[model samples]
Target chain A: MMWLFLVTDALLFAGFLGGYAFCRLASDKPWPDRTQVFDLTFITLMTFALITSSTTMASAVLAARNGRLQAARGFLLVTALIGLGFLGMQAVEWSHFIHAGARMDSNPWGVPGFSSYFFLITGFHGTHVLIGVVVLLLTTLRSLQRSNADELVEVVGLYWHFVDLVWVFVFGCYYLV
Target chain B: MSSQSGVSSYRTYWIGWLVLLILTVGMVFSGAKPVLVGGMLAKASIITLLYMHLMHERRRLVWTILLGIFLTSAVLVVLSVPDGMAM
Candidate 1:
């Protein structure tokens, strides 16, 4: 069921990205150069944070499988913290962009589509990360109780990895090429 | 799927994480270069296959996931071509 949800969610993102590509190519106005408007260093740090959270999530799953409940709880807590850190950075980035006059309807960069797509796509992905963090928190609590959380850890790990996977595409399309 | 014991070891996950980190740095340095897309694809595949344990899953399940991705990509590409051509 999670796989099915992921597959359909991926298709939804594909459609949004495809529409973004169309707008970018069809627009007469020059698209805003990503590097010019966004902080690459900050975004890179966010990427690392997210990937590290995935690592921590994997550790949590492994520890659970090994019946190390305390270790699993620790790892899950770390994962949640890292995810929260990533979202915090995103909030900062969004605020900076907004202060620079970028919005869904208008942008100082002259290409409205760029800001529109940027906010829409990144905002969508960020929301997923936020939800993942909340879910991780709950999973961590369950781990602390020493419940039979091995299966629960695996399911949550799948969702966490999916969030990270989506960010890979988001970073590629929005920040890189 | 096999039991939890069949899951890849922690070392495998660490290696995958390291590779993904390297790819993220590579993409940052590459800027908006076309090669960044390849790096992103590689990173995504590593996380899906190793970290997500899809590689150890049953072959039929793996194939289904791959097919879903492929079909989505094909549909999106086909849909985008006309708009791209119109540009």
Candidate 2:
């Protein structure tokens, strides 16, 4: 069930990225140099936070399956905190981008498509991260109250990892590629 | 399956994380388009297989998801981008 949901959601992103590619390629102007526009160090930190949280999420699922409820709770809490931090980092990145004159319709980079797609895609991914954090927190609270099925943790872990997976593409396409 | 312990499971996830980290960093430093896209795909595969536990799923499910997204995206790009490029 979750797998089906994730597959559909991934197709949604693929569509967005496809549109982005079309806009980028269709534009005659040169695209902004990614390195000049983005602070790679900060972006790397955001990626680290997300990837670490994913690891912690996987650990939580394993601990739950192993019948270590306390460990599961601990890991879930850690994962949620890291996810929250990643959101904050993303906010900072967005703020910086805006301050540098990037907007939905225009940017200092000359090619309007660059900033438009950057915000559109990353904004969509950030919303997913926000929802994942909220879900992680709820799962953590639920774990504290009762012994839930390990599958619950695994299901939530899948959602969290899927969010991370999307960011892997966003980061690659926007920041690196 | 039963023989694999919790510590080992944790180690596997961390190793996956480590590889993802390396690929991200490598892509950041390397300006080559092929390397960037290659690393991106590798990272995506690792996240899907290891982090998302797609590796344990049935083969049909795996192919469905992978091919569904790949083909759709490929069609989207291949059909649209050449016209854009020609403009």
Candidate 3:
């Protein structure tokens, strides 16, 4: 049951990536220099922040499984805080791009590939982040209600880890190569 | 017990994920195109394999379904991009 959701979620992302690549390949001109315009310094830090949050979320889930509700809540709160930080960084990146006057309509690098991909792919990912934030909030609420938190932690951890996995691919496809 | 079922029960994070992170950044600064491409493949494989690994351990039915789905997607990718893509 829990596992099914993750696979479905991954497939959804697969569709987004496929559509992104189709547009990129289907275009006539050269592909954009992803690394040059990406501002790796910002995304690198964002990756680190999100990865740290996953580690913390793992620990929180472990604590919950071991029957430590208070500790679980503490770690979950930290995970949420870190998630918020990543979201803030994402907002900053978008703001910088906006201020630089990049949009779906125009490609500054003269390659619509980058411009189109930048909006669609990251926009899909940002939506996932928002959903993740909401799930974490609900998990926190469940922490207060559940007498046994293991099942809740396990479910949330599955989603949290999936989010991390998604970013791992995104980081590769968008930033590195 | 056979060697393969035994293999499926064991679990660990690949150390390469940590190494790949540093390698990616280094490749960025080194001006080596091959390193960047190779590093990207290595890193993407790690994420894909790790996700598949976890899913296999958690739910066998979904594992089978996802495997079929992934394989089909791979075919589509090979037919499509400069390759079918992550879709």
Candidate 4:
């Protein structure tokens, strides 16, 4: 059921990307240069944090499955911390963009869709990260009290990894392309 | 997928992480659209297969998930891009 949900969620993102393509390709005005607007160094750091958290989550799952409850809980705690850090970095990015006069309807960039889609796509993904962090913390707390089900750890790991997967495309299409 | 001991499992995840990082760096350096798209796909595959353990699933389930999303997404992109360019 979890896998099925992920597939559907992924399809939803696929639609978003498709629409992003339409808006970008169809626009007469040039899309804003991402390099001018974004701090690539910070974005790269965000990516590193996410990917590392994913590895931690995976390790947590393995440790849980192997009956190392304490180790699993430790890994989960680290993953949650990293996830929170990623969200903090995203907040900084959003703050920088807003201070530069970007908004839902308009931005300093000539192409309105650029900022619109930027916020829409990244905002949606950021919300997922936030939710994942909350879930990880809750799970860690539960496991700290007593060992939780192994499947539960695996399922949460799946969601965390899926979030990372979506960011790969967002980073590629929005920032790199 | 064969059962990996705890050490090897952690090692596998880190290896996957390394590959993803390398791909990300390459994409950052290569601004070409094709290279970016290709790198993005590769990273997604690695996350799905290795980190998510999709490779451990039965063949039928794997095909269903991959094809369902991949084909539909491809169609959406293929149709959207050209029509958009023609606009």
For every prediction, compared with the true complex, DockQ reads 0.72, 0.64, 0.22, 0.69
TM-score of 3: 0.79
- Model 4 lDDT tens row, B11-61: 888898898888888888788888887998899998888888888787798
* Model 2 error, position A82 (Å): 0.8
Better of 1 and 2 by lDDT: 1
lDDT of 2 by residue, B17-67 (tens): 899889888888886899988998899899888877777777788888888
Model 1 lDDT, residue A97, Cα: 96
Model 2 C-alpha lDDT per residue in residues A1-177, reported as the tens digit of each score: 888888889888988888888887888898788778888999999999998999999899888888888899899999999998998998999999999998999888789889888888998998998899898888888644655557778888889999999988888877876
lDDT of 3 by residue, B23-87 (tens): 55775676465876576556555544442334335366646755766785796577666543333
Q: What tens digits encode model 4's per-residue C-alpha lDDT throughout A29-115?
A: 988888888989789889989989999999998988888888999999999999999999999999999999998889888888888
A-chain TM-score of every model: 0.96, 0.96, 0.91, 0.96
Q: Any idea what lDDT model 3 has?
A: 0.66
lDDT, residue B22, model 4: 89
Give the lowest summed-lDDT range of ten residues in model 4 chain A. A142-151
Candidate 3 residue A108 Cα shift, in angstroms, is: 2.0
| Native contacts matched by each model | 0.81, 0.78, 0.17, 0.78
lDDT of 1 by residue, B1-87 (tens): 335435547787788788998889888887656778789889988888878888778789899999989888888878786777588
State the RMSD for candidate 3: 5.2
